[model samples]
Target: MHVPDGFIDAPTSAVAGVVAAGALAVSLRGARRELDERTAPLAGLVAAFIFAVQMLNFPVAAGTSGHLLGGALAAILVGPYTGVLCVSVVLLMQGVLFADGGLTALGVNITDMAVTTTVVAYAVFRALLSVLPRRRRAVTVASFVAALVSVPAAACVFTLVYAIGGTTDVPIGKVATAMIGVHVLIGVGEAVITALTVSAVVAVRPDLVHGARGLRQRLKLRVDGELVDVPAAAEPVAARTSRRTLWVTGLVTSLVLAGFVSFYASSSPDGLEKVAHDKGIDAGARPHTASGSPLAGYGVKDVADARLSGGLAGVIGVGVTVVAGSTVFWAVRRRRGTDVSPASTAGTGV
Candidate 1:
C-alpha cells in the first residue's frame, strides 16, 4: 500500500527514510555479490516487470483489489539484495514519474514494501529450499511459499507503520486484521505468478535463477551396482547451452504483459485503497505532489482515449524502468568486476 504524504508525520517519515537509506546501502553491497552478466540484466527486467504488472490491478472485495508486489518474484528470479533494489526502483519510479506513491512517504513505502517483503520472502525461500528436495519442483514450491508469505508480512509491517504514524484514531487491531486479511488473498496471486515465473526461468536457465543455482542435480550412472555423479564436462553440450534463448523468451513475455495484456486488467481499486476507503484510514491522506503532472493516473496527459492513454503510459513506463534499472545494475556489476580484477587483486594476494 502506498502511504501518501499526510498519513505519517515528519518525525516518523524521517525515521523511515534513515532506515530505508541504510537498507539500500546494504543492498548495494549485497547486490555486488549477487550480480553477474546474466543476472544483472535480469535484475533490471525484474524491476520493469514489477512496474508493468503493478499497472494491472485486479479487484478483490467490494472496493479492494490486488496486484503483484514482485518481492518474491524478484528474489526468486534474481537475488534478495537485488530484489530489494528492484522493488525500490519501481516505487521510486511510481512516486517520481507517475505520481502513484507519495513523495513524502517514499521511505515508508520502501521500508514496509521493499525491505520487509524482500527479507521475509527470501528468508522463507532459502529456508524452504534448505529443507525440501533440491529439485526444480522444490524451487517452485519454495517460490510459492515465499511469495505467499511476503504479502501478508508486508501488510503487517504497514499496520505497524500506520500504528506509529497514522493520523486517524482507528483501532490498530482492526487495521491489522483488514490489512492482513485482504493481503492474504493478494498473496495467493503473488505466489502463483512467482511460482510460474520462477519455474519458467529454472526450466530454461536454471543458472539465471540465483535461488536454483546449486539445486541442479547431477546426472548419475549406475556402475558396478553403484551410482556415480557426472561432472559438468560429461553432460551433453545441448544441456549446457547458454540461456540467452530463455532470457529472450522471458523478456518477450514481460513485454507482452506490459504492452498488451495489461490493457485488459481491472479498473477497481487495489487492496490498500479498498481497505483505506472502507476504514476511513485515508482521511488524512494528502494529494500526491505529482498528481497534477500530465501523466497523473497511469494515462498520458492529453491522450483522450482511455485505452490509448493507458497503453501509452504502460509502454513508456516499461521503457523508462528498463533503461533506469539496467543502468543502475550495470553500474553495480561494473563495480564488482573492478573489485575482482586480477590487477586489483595482485597486491592483496601476496
Candidate 2:
C-alpha cells in the first residue's frame, strides 16, 4: 500500500516525515545493540530477501493479492530495531530505484509499513513467546500470529492517517472498514510466509535467528526436585552449518524468488490497491516522480520482453538493496565498535 504523492497534503506529510525521521534515528541507535558480526550481514540479506519476496504477490481474494510485508519475518529472524531498518531500506530502494512507492510520501510509507508493522509484530511476538512453551515451534507460531495481526494493524494506521489527511472526500468509516477487511485477508498470507521462513531458518541454525537465541540448548537440571539453568559451558556444541553456507544459500534463494518465481505472481491489485480504488482513497494520487527512470515500474525502459525485463529489474533491485543495506549496517556496526573501543581502552588503563 504505497501512498502515492498527493494522497496526503503537505502539512500531514511533513508531520509524518518528522515521525519517521525520529523513529529511524531511534532505530539506528538501538540497532547497535542488535547488530554484530553475524547479524549485521544477515540483516542486510533480510532486507534484500524482503524486497525479493515482495515481488511475488499472491492471490488473496478473487480480485486482490498481497505480498510479504516482511516485518514479522525480519523481526523474528533478526532483531526488531534492525527489522525496522531492514524494511525501511527496502522501501527506500523501492521509492528511489523502482519508483514503486512515492518519494514525497516516503514518511507515510515508512511510518505505516515499516514502523507500524515492525513494532506491532514484534510486540505481539514477544508477548506470545513469553507465555507460550519455549520450543522452536512456538517461535514459528508466534511469528504467524504476529504477522497476522501486523497487516491489519498497518491498515488501521493507514486509515487513521487518511482520515486526518486524505485528499479525497471518502467517508472515514467506510475507508476503515474496507481497508481493514481486505488487509485481514492479506494478513493470512503474511502470516504463512513469515512462519515458513522463520521455521526454515530456525531449523537450520536456531542460533542465527534472533528470537531463537536463548531458546536453544536451554538445559534445566533437577536439584532437590527443582529445575535450574545449566551453565553455558555445560551445553554441547550445536550441530550447525557454517555461516558462510547459510548466507550464500539465503542470497541464492532470494535471487531465485525474485528473478524467476516473481514472474508467476498474481497480477491482480493488492489489498490496499483494491480498497483504494473501491473507496476512492486514491482519487488524488499523483504520478511517481521517478516514472521516467529506466527501472521505473519494475521493468527496464524500452524492454519489450516482459519476463526478461522484470527479472532483470528484480535482480538489480536485490543487488542494489543488499549493497545499500549492508553499507548502512556496516557503518552503524563500525561506529558502535569505535564507541566501545574508547571505553574499553580507558577501563584497561585504569
Candidate 3:
C-alpha cells in the first residue's frame, strides 16, 4: 500500500527514509551479481508490467479492492534484489508523476511495500522450492504461496509502523485486525495474479524466469549397472524465444493492460485506503505534494475525456517507468562488466 504524507510523523518517516536508502544501496550491489545481458533488459520490462497490472484493481470484499504488489511476481521472474528495485521504480514514478503515493511518505511506502514484501516473498519462495518437487509447476506454486504471504506481511509491517508513529487516537489492536483482515482477502488476489503471470513466463521462456532456472532434472544413464549423470551438452536444447520478441510482447501487453483494460478495473478503494478510512488512520493524512501535477490522480490535465486522459496517463507512466528502470539496470550491468580486472581480460584474450 502507498502510505500518504502525515500518516507517519517526520522522525519516523525520516528513519524509514534512511532504511529505504540503505536497502536500495544494498540492492544495487546485489543486483550487479544478478543482472546480465539477458536479465538486465527483462528487469525493466518487469517493472513496467508491474506498474500496468497494479492499475487493474480487482474487488476483494464489499467496497474493498486489491491489486498486484509485484514483489512475488517480480522476484520469481527476475531476482529478488532486482525485484525490490523494480517495485521501487514504480513507486517513484507513481509518487512524482501520478501523485498516487505521497512524496513525504515515500520512505514509508518503500520500506513497507518494496523492502518488506520482496524479502518476505523471496524467502517464502526459496523455502517452498526446497521442500516441493523441483518442477516447473512447483515454481508457479511457490509463487502463489509467496505472494499470498507477502501481502499480509506488508500489512503487519504497516500496522507496526502506525503503532509506533500513529498520529490519531485509534487503537493499535483495531488497526492491526482490520488491516490484516482485509489484506488477507487481498492476498488471494495477489496469489492468483502472481501464479498466473509466473506460469505464463515460465511456459514461454523458462530461461528468463529466475526462480524456474535449473528446473530440468539432469538425465541419468545406466552404465555397467551404475547410474551416471549425462553430460549437460548431450541433452537436447530447447529453442529459445528471442529476448527482443519477449520484451516487445511484454511491453505491448503492459500497454494494453494500462492504456485500455485499466478503464474496466474496479473503482472501489483498495485494501489500505478502505482500512484507513474505516479505522480513522487517515485522520492525519496530508495532501500529496504532487497533487497539482498535470498527471495527478492518473489523469492528464486539460484532457476532457475521462477515458482518454486516464489512458494517456497510463501510457506515459509505462513509457517513463521502462526507460528509467532500463537506464538504472543497464548502468548496473555496465558496472558489473567494468568490474573485470584487466589481467583477467587479457588472460581471456578479450
* TM-score of candidate 1 relative to the true fold: 0.93
Candidate 3 residues 166-196, lDDT tens each? 8888999999999999999999999999999
List of clashing residue pairs for candidate 2: none
TM-score of decoy 2: 0.94
Tens digits of per-residue lDDT, candidate 2, 1-350, equal 77788888888998999999999999999899899998888998999999999999999888999988888888888899999999999999999988887899999999999999999999999999999887888999999999999999999999999889989999999998998998999999999999999998888888889998877746789999999989977876445777788889989999999888999999999988898888887889999998888999888888899999999999999999999999999998988887786667785864
Give lDDT tens digits, candidate 1, residues 1-350.
77778877788888999999999999999999999987898888889989988887776677667999988888878889999999999999989888987898999999988999999999999998888987889999999999999999999988998899888888999999989999999999888888988887777678778899878867899999999988867754335546666656556666777767888988788888888888998898898999987777888899998878888888888888988999999999999987886776787963
- The CA lDDT of each predicted structure is 0.86, 0.90, 0.91
- Candidate 1 residue spans exceeding 4 A from truth: 220-232, 236-243, 341-344, 347-350
Q: Which ten residues in a row have the lowest lDDT in candidate 2?
A: 232-241
Of 1 and 3, the candidate ranking higher by lDDT: 3
* Candidate with best lDDT: 3
* TM-score for each of the candidates: 0.93, 0.94, 0.94
Which residue runs of candidate 2 sit more than 4 Å off their true CA positions? Answer: 217-238, 344-350
Ranking by lDDT: 3, 2, 1
